[model samples]
Target: MIYRKDRKVLKRVDFGAAKNSLMGVLAALVVYALVIAWGRVYEAFQLETLLVGGAVVVVTAFRLWLVARFDALYGAGPARWRKLFAFGLILHALVWGLLPAWLVWRVGTGFNFFVVILYNVGVTTALGSSWMAGLKVRQFYILLMFLPVIGALFLGGGLREWLLALLVAAYTFYLFRLYRGQYELFWHAVTRERRSGGAERRRELPASTDIQLSLVYRLAHELRTPMNSVMGMMSLLEDTRLDDEQKEYLQVAGQSGKLMITLIDDVLDYSRILTGRITLSPDYFDLRGAMEQILEAFGPMAQAKGLELAAVVDRLLPKRVRGDRDRLMQVLTNLLSNAIKFSERGEVRMDVDFTAEGEHDGVLRVRVSDQGAGMDTDTLKHLFEDQFLDGAVDAFAVRHTGFGLLVCKGLIEAMGGAIGAESVEGEGSTFWFTVRLGMQADMSESSKLSGAMADIQGVVVGAGAGSLACLQEEFEALGSQCQGARDYDHALQALRAGHREQAEFDLLLVDTHGRRELALNLCRNVLEDPSLRPVKLMLMCTIEERGEPTVQRLVDKHGLVTLVRPVHRTGLRIALGRLLGVPRSQPVQDLPTETPEERRRRKLYRLLLVEDNEVNQLVTRGMLSKLGYQVKTVNNAETALALLDQENFDLVLMDCMMPDLDGFAATRDLREREQREQRPRTPVIAITANTAEGAQARCLAAGMDDFLAKPVHLQELETVLRRWLSREDDSAAEEPDSE
Candidate 1:
């Protein structure tokens, strides 16, 4: 590949071969001269021989000197390839061709043996030299070697001479081919050496890269271990009686830890994608279930922002579809997260519809649209370019490489899907993607919206066309009759026209996104009208608008239900259920009193925590204890394995990285041992800070029943416990004494 560059390398191969062959050629010429002089050969033949041999020796010596000079100026580019080739041809012709032809004509058969020997020596010496070993130079030398034989073949007087000339010509051709083959072999070796040198450098780069990535991963986990303890301790402290100042301090500490955790997560995610660690695990999962879980995770966040978050799925879509549930959730979470981060007042909505479906598969189009501060053309151009998030940086709230949208793009593409965004700078943005999923034939129809708000009449006013359409559809889906109005005036006129108590709608939904003032005035007018005053009033306002005095007065004094911006279909259902006295199918979980046996059962629920770091162990143990769990921790996997035989653990919290027998190996061993002894398999949860893409899958492959990352929150830990341990076996045990 670097052939052109190699031309600059003055090969030691050339100079060494040139010097050796010069000695051989000169010696051969000396032998020829001595033979002629000693024999007292014919005067003419002797003179001719002396002249030719003298010329040959002088030319050969000069050529050798030239080669030396060329070597010295190899890098100077003065001796072009064509010049070298011409020189080789001319010199070889004089020594090998012309000398032989002249001897054949003057001495005839008498000195033919000497002539043959001289020709052999000249051609052999030239072939042996590396100076003319270049492909082009060697070719020229071969051509010159055959010239004398060709001349003698037509001009020879005898058959023997012609045959001898033919043989010599054949021999010359054979030597040239041999040297050419050798030249090619040598070139190949050189190229191979250069390539291997480059390969070695390339290999070294990835090795160093691997080392650096490993260090970052380890450092992140190490940092998370301590932060987990601090946050967990703070959470425990918050549960205890504390003054407002102490509570605020703990809150600030918790917030800082959460932010740090987010940053760590972003780093790990980018690294995982960069290192090709992510892969899809497709399985049939409830689409509704996935959507609901995301809503649940971000509902509090949306609510905190005083925003509405909801999903609207197509009615004909399959209840369960095949896809990577976790990854899809992650993508949606990232989109929803970005929406919430940038949106201060408007709604964040997720819209899902069936794009295509067959007997065993379906394609779903998902869009996470938000009425937030959108992007300009310039920002959109580089929206997905790799960069770190910073304060006031494109509305990203974390300090990490690339925004979440980049990660979403990678995941969607990996899933054989495409993603894009549409935004108006001051209006909002909508991010959408399409994914192929397997169809669940056996799944029942979804009950998420079944009777969510029955027997209710509602009117949505002053909402954007999209928002108004979504709200009306949601209400109708919940068995309610609803109508949409473009503005507050239209809604007020409709309410007044239906003045009869029975004909009037029971609920009024107002969008305060752009017409907050008009919406407030309408709400006040509704309160004044006796016919409309009884209607349950729910005003949608931006987070910033919700803090305004007028909005607060409307909510506090007028007893109006307030739904935050970007209201979800589910969120709307919940808000409607509260306002219109509609009974929800599945109410929020309520804590019930436990009897003595229940308490005893809970006390018996045991957890074995396997962690190497003392801080992690303490933090984990404390968090578990706060949840009324009985925990036994060991510093290594060996001790954990030993304890499994001594006591039956309901669940094992395995730390993936340890001094000996890491979580993966330990889980595998535990699973094998349980199978051999025919004992009930205990659940092993990987409690690692290793957030690499395939880390959880690795744990699962190693027989882990679940995964919980480091600085495990109390809720996640409790959820893992409840999922693995039977509910009847669950109990609120007495908190263990602090160590």
Candidate 2:
């Protein structure tokens, strides 16, 4: 693992590893000196004594070298340095721990014998206090240092020897118990020091926008690609035959993938929570069904860990609710994961409470309790605060809890709720959160699109005529007004013309148009105009123009979204989404009046699946075909679009990124064609591997009806099918009085 700049704690941990190693070397030197001073006294054992002394001296020399070069290598890289430190620590422990035992056994029943035994005990004591010991008591060095001496002591036959061995055995037991206290004390002290010293130095993502984008980049590139393969294989394999053992293995693999995806989701959610940009997609959901799914998902995990997992839902808790189901589940799942992680074997249980506020809404409070190592008051006070990231008293156990709990807090508060914790250091902990939400929505409630971005203004100015028509059509297809200008002056005039009525145009696309000097001046004028500051400026330039000094200066100075010439709609939506936010969807009143029964009646649905990855196409096609829908697969957006023109399909499962024509661009093209030809809009659902922050927004902005992350699950696929295929009204609300 590399030591990143923001995680200063890693530096401190490495320092702990690198420090005090010199003293360990010094301890070895003392043993070597003892060997030399006493070896010559026993003449009869002269040869053996010399050999022992020489070996100790040689090992001591090596340790001294290790101590010298050790800390210097940490700067080289963390993983290599960590391995080196472990190798050296194990070497020293094995040598120093066995030397005194070997010497003591070689010369039995004498003061010098007692002296050797004392040295053995002293070295064992040294190991009980080592850096690695702090992380774990049964660490490698502990086993190396303690086992040999303790085994040798018991091997002696005399009663007195047996008694001394028993004493040392008791000492070893004491050391284990002592380490437990020291470990907590170590973290407690660390937590206090960081708070006092670094209260103001906490690492905050520089700007929320940068943070969201950075996390999104990592999720899409680093996390989701591998996960797509993992979950994809898992989903594909599920449709095949398998023995029970094989099924179990597949189940575990699937569970592991689920947990990994949850962790990946948390990273993005935390960023959203931190930036106050996280949206809760409130809809109809079964509270009981969600609870049952969570428990079922975590059952194997708990059973694998030998911990009992249980839950208690209050009689008053509603069985259905209209709320952000995913977020609610995420918060509870986070709590369950933390409880399971901290517990060794005891039960981790969830308890729910509810209080009805009216006929339609009420408060939901959930508590997750664990019989595990808990936190001290100091730690409990700062659990949700950033300063606690130095970690809580449980050290390794609580390491993963820090930001997760913070996200829970942010999410709960955002739902007009609150979250907190209660713990007694040795007993256990209970984490809880509360949210006020409406009871289950009426199943008949029609799907409604948020209408905030129903209409907006955009202007295109560029000599890049190749892209102008595409850009103008894309904007109009999204229900936005877009005007093209002949040049910089005309562009400025177009923007000023819309100024009074628009207050601010949603976006301004400026193409360098191979006229760098004129384009550069237009940018300066637009930026200088106070009235236009609110409008997002997107600069389109050629390869040479993009790198030109003045253009680069303009981009860097103003933080403009710069794209290479012949900008694709997919790239344009992402860039603008980051600046202007998720494309607003059409108002409910503006949507086509398609009846639910009309959609549900199309059972023999012809579906078009567009994806570049062959494996994904196979996996998706197989999964969809299993449900008995006629499926057509294409390698990219262009092929899919060409096919749609030739054959009629009930819906399109469009992958957002592909060759020349990406999903967003393709969807826009199809929509533009449909609008121009007076064809009814086809239901286009975006299937993408990208977890970028505004992905859903971009999809909706491009005219997609819905969105799904890649490596789609069978159950989720089925749900999306029912929801979109016929505008499925599956989640019927229960009577408020029903449990």
Best by TM-score: 1
TM-score of 1: 0.56
Candidate 2: where are CA atoms >4 Å away?
1-69, 72-211, 214-218, 241-245, 281-313, 316-325, 355-364, 387-402, 437-607, 625-632, 643-650, 675-682, 691-694, 718-739
Q: Per-model C-alpha lDDT, please? A: 0.69, 0.67
Q: Which predicted model would earn the best lDDT?
A: 1
Count clashing pairs, candidate 1: 11
lDDT of 1: 0.69
Tens digit per residue, CA lDDT, model 1, 1-739: 3443244333545445555556555665655565466534445565666677677777766666656676554545545633653575467565665655655676554444454555554556456445434666666666666676558654976755554454344445545545554565455434423564677676656564475468558756766666665566566566666556545645754675687677677666666666676668888887776787677778778867767676666755777788888888888888888899889986788888885556788788998888888888877866776643232342212233254777788788888888988999889999899878778675554544455456868888877655666676666666677788767898898787777535777688887765678889998898777777767888887656778888888778777777765555556667766676666677688665245544555566788888887656766787777666688888999998998988887788888888758889998999999999999988888887777657788888999989988778888887777777764323234334222
